[model samples]
Structure formats: C-alpha cells, structure tokens
Target: MKLRIFHQTVYRYDRPARNLVQSLRLTPSVSEGQRTHDWQIDVQGGIRGPGFRDGAGDWIEGWTVRGPTEEVTVTVTGRIETRDTAGVLRGHRELINPLAYLRDTPATKPDQALRDLALTAKDAADPLGLAHRLSAVVSDAIAYMPGQTGFHTTAAEALEKGEGVCQDHAHALIALARLHDLPARYASGYLHTTADGDAHEAAHAWAEINVPGLGWVGFDPANRCCPDERYVRLGSGLDASDAAPIRGIAAGHGIETMDVAVSVEEVERFQTQSQSQTQS
Candidate 1:
C-alpha cells in the first residue's frame, strides 16, 4: 500500500519560552514491510542539527528553536510504501540487545494485578503462542475509551480502570510481556485508519515482543490484531515515553498546551496497484 501522511504539532505557552530543544524520531527505518519514499519534518523558525540513529534503531534528529517564542509548530509530511508482513519487523538492524528491554519503566512497571494477569497468559504451548495469549488477555481486560485516561497514566492504573487508548494498551501489554520475562518494547508510528472513515485520524502505538526465533513481532491489543500494511513502524523503546515520536524540553514555561493533528490516507487504489506492480 502507498500512503501519504501529514502531522502537525503546535505548542502554546502562557509565557514565552526562553529556549527550546527537541529530539525527533519521526522517520521510519527500512524493514521488510515498509520503505519511506520522501519525508520531511519542518520546524517553524528552528535550526536543524546533526541527526543520527540510536542504538534502538531509530533516527534521532535535533532541532533548536530560539525563543522569546510563544508558540512552536512542527510540521511533518511524508510518503511511504508499505506491505503487510503480519507485524513482523524484518531486516531491521539495531545495536541494543533484546534483554535490554527487560528493565521496567515507571509507566510499565507491573503491579500485583498485572503479575496475576500474566499468569493467565501462560501456556504449555510455544512461546509465540503464549505471547498471543497475553495479547488476548490484555484485549479482553481493557476497553478502548479515548478520554478515560491521560498520558501520565501507568499500565497498572489503566488496567485497574479497565479503559484507555492505544498508548495505555501498549504500556499494559509491555508490562504483561515483561512480567513473563519476555523482552518487549513500545513502538510508535502512524496508522491509516481514516481511509476507512474517509477522514483524517491520529497516530498509532503498539507493543513489540522479541520471541526466540521471531525477532520482533508487533502486537496491538487495542486493535486485537498485529500491525499490517495499514501501519507504519517508527521508533521503539522501553515504554511510550521512551519511544515518543517527539521529546523535548522548553525553558521558562508557565503552562504549555499542545495540539496535534494527523492525517493518513492511502493513495488512490489505482496508484497503489501501479506502485505495487512496478516494484514487483
């Protein structure tokens, strides 16, 4: 599938920001299922710095927007060709070991409840099967309610509430996966959901578990399925906050408000078909 994506994030502050520095993991790395065509991130009134890929296999770029500034806008536009690899991340290179993800983060630390829930996912079956079982366990426990939780909500809190958005699901899944000693990390990306509704939509999140032989396989319990062609995998880390697409600090802030708008859509069906044929 061929898709076009547009994402804009704007920040407003009560007081002017003295200075700002942002690290962006906005570009998707090449894997078996997807390849970026042309992508650009434009930071209004910002100067670009050297960018490099981190040990986790994500491209990290630095940008500085000098302030005395009240607002900052970051605009991203891109085109990518994606294939359905059943959520398996293939042909991706990274320096970090899978066991590195075993460490717990504040947001994904499993509580007793999560530990007990992890026991339910255990099986005498294969490790891959057990992972899928855990995914189902999380899916059955949490219902998708967008406004039910906030960004700071932890996996245990979201599970206790029994409701949260995709980020919550990813966090909860990571917690459960780690409870069983499985190496799991949080993945941030864009999903082509609006093509189904004919409207613009938001970004997407999921969990990737490193199975014995499977390497990294993504599972989105919120959707009750793994990522497919509709999904675009970006950076990954120990948890949501670690894998955030954009992470930064603004100096001299009274109160900062952020607004994000994302649009993802498949190119025309004919265009998709033509692209596929050319590649084949």
Candidate 2:
C-alpha cells in the first residue's frame, strides 16, 4: 500500500526566542518492505543543516533559526510505499550491536511490577514466541487510555496504573523485554490505521526486539500485533524521548507551548496537475 503523511508541529513562545535549533528524525526507513517516494521537511525560515543516518539506521537532520519571533512551525509532507513484513525489520543498515539496546533508560526502567510481568513469558519455548506473548500480556495489563500518563511516566508506573497510551505500552514492553535478557528498544513512527485500530494519537510509537535470527522485529503492544503495511518505521531509541521525531531547544528564556497535528491516508487515484505517471 501507498500512503501520504502530513505532520505539522508549531511552537509558540510568550516572548521572542533569540535562537532555536532542532534535531529531526522524521524520514521513513527504506528496506525491502517499505520505500519512500518523496519527502520534505520545512522549518519556517530556518536554515536546514547537514543530515546523516545514525548507527540505529535512523536519518537525523539538523535545522537552526535565529529569530526575534514568537512562533515557529515545522511541516512535513511525504509519500511512501509499504508492505507487510510481519514486523520483521529486514535489510536495514545499522552499526550498533543488538546488545546495545539491552541497556535501560529512565523511561523504560522496570520495577517489581514489570519484572513480574516478564516472568509470565519466561517459560515460552522460543524467543519469537515469547516476544509475542509478552506483547499481548502488556496490552492486556494496560488498557489503551489516553490522558492517563505524561511524558515522564515510567513503564512500571504505567503498568501499575493499568492504562496508558501507545507510548506507555512501548515503554513497558521495552522494560519487559530487557528483564528477559532480550535486546529491545522504543520505536517512533507513523501508522495508517485500519477500521479496528486502537490508536493513541495521530503520531504513533511501538517497540522493537532483536531475536537471534531476526535483527529487529517490531511489536505494537497497544494494538496487539506486529507492524505491517499500515506502519512506517522512522527511528528507534532507548525510549520515546530519545526517539522523538523532533527535539529542540530555544536560546531565550521564554516559555514554550507546542501543538502537533498529523495525518496519514492511503493514496488512491488522483490526477496530478501535471498529468504525470503516479505509481508509488
């Protein structure tokens, strides 16, 4: 399937910001299962800097804007072609060893609750089977409830509360995987939902585990399934904060407010203004 995405993030400051710099991980991953047709990121009046693919196979780009202004908008528009890879990440280049992801971050740290959850899967026969079982266990333990958690909420906290959004699920799953001595990391991206989707927000997140035979396999505990054609893999990190689509800081001391809007839809028939060939 081919899909188009439009994502816009706006920051409004109470006072003029002297300077702003942002690191963006907004490009989609390319492999046998997915490919980008066209993509662009526009930071209003900001100078686009150098960009490179990191050891995790994520494209990182830099942007800077010197401003005596109160508002900045980052707009992203793109088209991509994707297929169902059954959540298996294949043929993607990366320099980081799988074991590196075993390390835990504050957002994904396991508590007694998470450790107990991991124990449920300890007796599974195979690594891949155990991974799926853990995913379902997390989904069941934590209902998909929006507005139930904040950015700083840890995986253990979410599990205790028994509800959270996709971010919470991803974090909890990461914690659980690590408790089992499996390498796992948080993944950030976009998802084009089907009719029965349980999406937390327009922007989406999930977790990835490295199996002995598989490099990185993605699992969405919130939706109880592996990533498929509806999913777009952007990047991965220890947790949501590390894998954020946009991370930035303003030089001035003005308070910052943010608003984000995102959209993803399947691309069908549409006559181009230039009337050119349009296959994704």
Candidate 1 C-alpha lDDT tens digits along 141-177: 9998888899899999999999988999999999988
Error of 1 at 104 (Å): 0.7
Locate the minimum summed-lDDT window of 10 residues in model 1. 193-202
Give, for candidate 2, the lowest lDDT window spanning 10 residues: 269-278
Candidate 1, number of clashes: 0
Q: How big is the positional error of residue 44 in model 2, measured in Å on the Cα after superposition?
A: 0.3
Clashing residue pair totals per candidate (backbone < 3 A): 0, 0
Task: Give lDDT tens digits, candidate 2, residues 1-280.
Answer: 8988999999999999967999999999767779999999999989999999999889999999999879999999999999999999998988999999999999998888888889998888999999999999999999999889998999989998999999999999999999988999999989887557555565899999998887789999988999999888888898999999999988988899999999887886333522565443
Cα lDDT of candidate 2 equals: 0.90
Off by over 4 Å in 1: 194-201, 269-280
Models 1 onward score TM values of 0.93, 0.94
